[model samples]
Target: MRKIPKPTLIAKDVFLECISTVGNLLLKQNYEKCQDLVEAAAQDFDNKFPLLEIYQIPRNLTVLGSIGKEEMKSVYTYRMVKDGMPGNTFYNTLKNSAPYGKCPLCSVRFVETLDHYLPKSLYPILSVVPVNLIPSCSSCNTGKKISFPTNSIEQTFHPYYDDIQDESWIKATLLPYDPFGFNYFVECPDSWEQIKKDRANNHFSSFKLNTLFTAHANEEFRGAKDHMKTLFNLHPDELIKHLDGAFRSRRDQLGINSWQAVMYYCLLKDNWFVQGGVLTF
Candidate 1:
């Protein structure tokens, strides 16, 4: 996953801005009463985030008198998401936080919306909290759904907190097939703790990223298939140099672990693929 710089928006400011637009007097009054609770939840998030202690945060805080979970969620869906609303600016900011508008969750798809890291349906108090929101594509967001963590290890990578961009853990292998198939996986270093490796593996597995990457990787190969065959016929050594350049370009433009980067790495590493195997496609 790509590392995203966290949004600078403050929770109290966003919470107040969102609640200010409520025309309903009763709802506004109830929301006014929960300012401290919302701020506390944000603080709890800030304190626990680095420690993977999200599962310990208070939940279903029935403290928003006359304001149930659904109402609190509307503060985001109705107020913040609507154009020209007070909270809309912050909403857009969070959604655009991903570098180059790519979803940090998968680093594959373009970011389409903001996802609640701690889903607002379950943790209403964090509905507007900047740290709790993540920029993600629709696919990644749908893959996540409203699933919440029950333990530290269950928590997926938080792009802002967990920077895996420089950490090249994704590995792709070119398998024998009519044309070919890619097998993608996460391989952490031996120095990492078992829990950390398991968490990474869980994140990779739960998202079905291997399948996602495989599809994209194959499509990429399809486009390059003819060029590779032509290059090998021109000169096999030239094909090696060309594949090396492709690997370098992808590694430089995208991060090392990107599907394209790993795909090129696999192609360059396998001499048979570069010299003759690619002709199958």
Candidate 2:
């Protein structure tokens, strides 16, 4: 999944107004009103908040349950009011929907439907927390990552918080026509052996990253795949030169258009293409 940069509160007036309207509805237990405010917010960015239907009832119900509690009460309430219908879920989806925040696996540009690193299905309570939201393609969201969990790191990288720049995520090798070619498995360093292994296996199998045929095959990555195929037919040295030039061309043409794509390409440049591997500049 490509990591998108943090968003500025650019739509300050709309954001604030919607937040205030929704917050009051929640306070007054006017759920229908809250939903309408959310619809408006979603409309501001196009009709992007479709998945919001799932979170609405659960969010409202959770808010009702936590109002009187002490510790996490405010946290949840603030999340509810602050996020409301469109607040957290809609905004997050909006950011993800941009061409910038795409899933490397399926290569679809998306908004809020990204699968949580730890599936929100598993941790529904934290669904609205910014830290829990991840922007990924719908195929990556639906085809794979169906309620999977990562025990190694209790939490996955937050697109807004974690510096994913340190990780070699795309370092994974693409296997044969496994239909789920996006499956990325790796041998972990001894220090992070079991955890990394578990993470890899879970990522590989659950996310269907290994599937040779994917929705992305027919859509976004068709050209990249054809290019790779041509390069693959060449000798190692030729392939390296070809790939290097190709990657360079991609960068030149798409110079960091979106935060997510930029981060993904940067990771590939650092970890794979320029790490003294087959590809060289």
Candidate 3:
């Protein structure tokens, strides 16, 4: 997963805006008790979220609308937190924070929507909290919908907090066949703690990243067939050097474990592949 910069929009400001909008709506609906409860919820939210202990808190249905928790969740999910006037501005800011408008969660698809790091349904108070919102693609958002970690070890890597790109963790192995294929896997450093390794594997599996990368690698290999043939004509020693250069280039452009870098590096290391394995295709 890619590390995303923290959003510039202040969380308190966004929370206040949401409260104001929702408060006005509640007043119009003649739910003064609910409006007062919302104010209390706002204070509780600030303590939980801004203080960074939100995960420990449980969903309090009592503070929600008089209509009930389900209705309150719907109002926040659809109206107040996602589609309302302030929400539009909030969503845009989070989306713009993504580098090159790409989803930070997978570093693949374009940023299409904001995902609640903590699902808004479970933590309605955090529905509009800037720190709780993440810019994401539809796939990542849907795959991760409403799933929160039960423990610290189970927590998926947060782009705002985790930056695993500094190391090479993802790896691939070539399948020598006519239509050469690859398999991607998480191979975390031996120095990493067991918890980190588990989390990395969890992130990869949860997003089905291995399947996605394998498909991409196959497509990339198809396009590089002619180039590989041309490189094979060069001295085998030079071919290794060229492949290493390509690996480095991809690593520099993307991260160390980017699919291209991993693919090229693995190919360069495989004696059969560097010599004549690719020619079979």
Candidate 4:
């Protein structure tokens, strides 16, 4: 997962407004109530976010409860896509959440979709909750996490709230010379293990991050066959230097504004700084 740029409260409100309008259009049973429901959802989503202004609405009543099929069937896409505002904004927002638009599940760069953390199939009403929606690569979206809740909130990483830009987000163990070449198994810390196991397994297996690509990169970085070889053989200073350089090198290589690039860099920085590396600036 990448480090997503937090959208301004106003921008989020804008998105909410659009969603409400669509909702109102679909559920036209009561015009006045539909207006109120839109207002309430905006307030609710805003109140949850600190450092953001709570947008005021005309009245406090909530009338509309769900998105009507009419709205869903309506075609809406953004500038980059053929459809127009709602579709485009949704796509761009999810794209921003991904690591260079790569799937978090498979790490593959392919056409992705907006995934509902709480599966929309089960809870269709939550389909538009901005916080509930995530950009996922095709394989993970279609093949793995469809409608499944692997763990509790405490055990899993919430893309909106959890900061994944640290080594602690995942613990990697290099495997011994293995036959399958399935090099490493990533686990959360022992303290977090029992509770997080299911979530971790889901994350690793679904995204395939524990596979060949990540392992190869890990080996290339340590100049070893696996993480243990790098850890046991390398000096602390040597580790610091390499990790530091790698982090710095990525900032320019991945393109600064890209959220995934920023996250990968932050993880590198945190890894070395924890080991006594000084911050120059």
Candidate 5:
């Protein structure tokens, strides 16, 4: 996963803007009695989010588009949290910050939308909190729909908080076949505590990262097969060197554990693979 820079927008500003828009809508809904409560709730939300203590925030407000009210057709109908306002600005900033505009959660798909790091449905107070929203591809967003961690240990790696890219953790293995099948997994370092490691594994499983990585790796292997054969034919002795160089290049461009880097490293380290074993596959 790619690391994401913290959003440039101020959380309090975004929260107040949302409160103003939603509060105006609430006023239109004849909920004048609740305005003071809404304002207080908004302030509370703004304060709590930056502390990374979202789990403690209460979900007591009954506003315009809360899930309990069938009158509100969609939770996102609340304009403050809706696209085209601060949400759009936040999304644009995140997308622009990403490497090649790819989703930070998977680093594969193009970022198409935002995922609520804390599901807005559960944490309605943070429905429009800038830091709670994450730029995501449709796949990761849809897959992560409504799932929130109950505690800090269960929390998935936040691209804004956790930077796994600095270290090598992702690993790949080639399966025996004519066109080899690849399996990808997160291999957490021993230095990490069990909770941290478990969370990493949970994040990988929750996002179906392995499945996505394997599909991409297979496509990459197919594309690289002919090139590997050509290179091996020209200079069999230099195949390992070429593969090592490729690994380093990809590692530098992406990260040490990027799929391409791990794949190249594995291929170079495998005696059979460097001798053009992949050619038979």
Candidate 6:
């Protein structure tokens, strides 16, 4: 949903920082032994990340010695996230990297944790990889997560890699029914490849952006109902003008596909809504 700068730190630096704080001698030695494989995997991740070729990298049962999936995952949970650990600095840095401190996935919720772009349970080698982690809200992080993308269309957008902010895709249509609310969707550019469009669509549905936006939009409309009624009573044109200005502001400040802008656009264009239809639910 939003593009964020990739972390300047690479895999080896973060790995070394974490391994330095480990008190277990044999475990530390084993982690050190795995460093070569970790760095190589990290390089493969960096190379294949943008292309959805990450599935090309191999997955194994363990990192090295007894450092299996959950153990590798704990390197993140204990060393990286736990307080006073040497690697906690990198953890906080990555967690704080969210743009304006908002979860890039939903853009509404404040970031609460760093989510593994690829689950650590499956890809243990990438458990501590920087690029594999994304700052996200608890809700977004817990929802149905990503797995291997067998093809281009199934791949979700990586905020650090994918930037769709330049174009408007998010759209809302007046339901004009008993609910009398708007439904959210995307209208991606025709110039984009079919696979690109599919990926955008997948990101929207996978994150449940439509449901999130609609719920918030209803709250906003309810709070602004009195103002809308007043504007409509004064003049229908005044209502449209207010919405027009609001849409422009939201579009300028947020991206054009932002729910607020599209919601305003939908309302302003609806004849029923402007001509005293503002009173309806």
Q: Alpha carbon lDDT of residue 191, candidate 1?
A: 77
- Per-candidate alpha-carbon RMSD to the true structure: 1.6, 11.1, 3.7, 9.8, 4.0, 1.6
Estimate the overall C-alpha local distance difference test score of candidate 5: 0.68
In order, what lDDT does every prediction score?
0.84, 0.40, 0.72, 0.44, 0.68, 0.84
How do the residues 1-281 of candidate 2 rate in per-residue lDDT, one tens digit apiece?
Answer: 34455444333332333344434545535333333333343333222122212223223223223232231233323533354544555545444444555554333344435454434343333333333345566666666643533233322233443332333433333323434233233334455545444544455456554343233332334345455445545654554565566555644544322222333343244334323332221
What order do candidates take by lDDT, descending? Answer: 1, 6, 3, 5, 4, 2
Clashes of 3: 0
Clashing pairs in 3: none
Clashes of 2: 21
Candidate 2 wrongly placed segments (more than 4 Å): 5-99, 104-109, 112-127, 146-150, 153-158, 161-184, 187-194, 212-240, 247-281
Q: What are the per-residue Cα lDDT tens digits for candidate 3 across 192-267?
A: 9887898888888877888878888889888886688677877667677888998999999877877788888888
- Per-residue lDDT tens digits for candidate 4, residues 1-281, read 44455434333343344444344444434333444443455446445433222112122222244444333223222222234554466556655667666554344455467665554444332334455556665655666533444224222344555444443434333222332122334445566645455656555565555553455544453443244235324655664555456556654554432233333344345543335332211
Those runs of model 4 whose alpha carbons end farther than 4 Å from true positions after fitting are 9-82, 97-99, 104-111, 150-155, 169-180, 190-198, 211-281
> Judged by lDDT relative to the true structure, which candidate is superior, 4 or 6?
6
Q: What's the CA RMSD of model 4 in angstroms?
A: 9.8
- The TM-scores, one per candidate, come to 0.95, 0.45, 0.83, 0.52, 0.81, 0.94
10 residues in a row with least lDDT, candidate 2: 45-54
**Residue-wise lDDT of candidate 6 within 7-37, one digit each (tens)?**
8887988988888978889888888888878
Off by over 4 Å in 6: 279-281
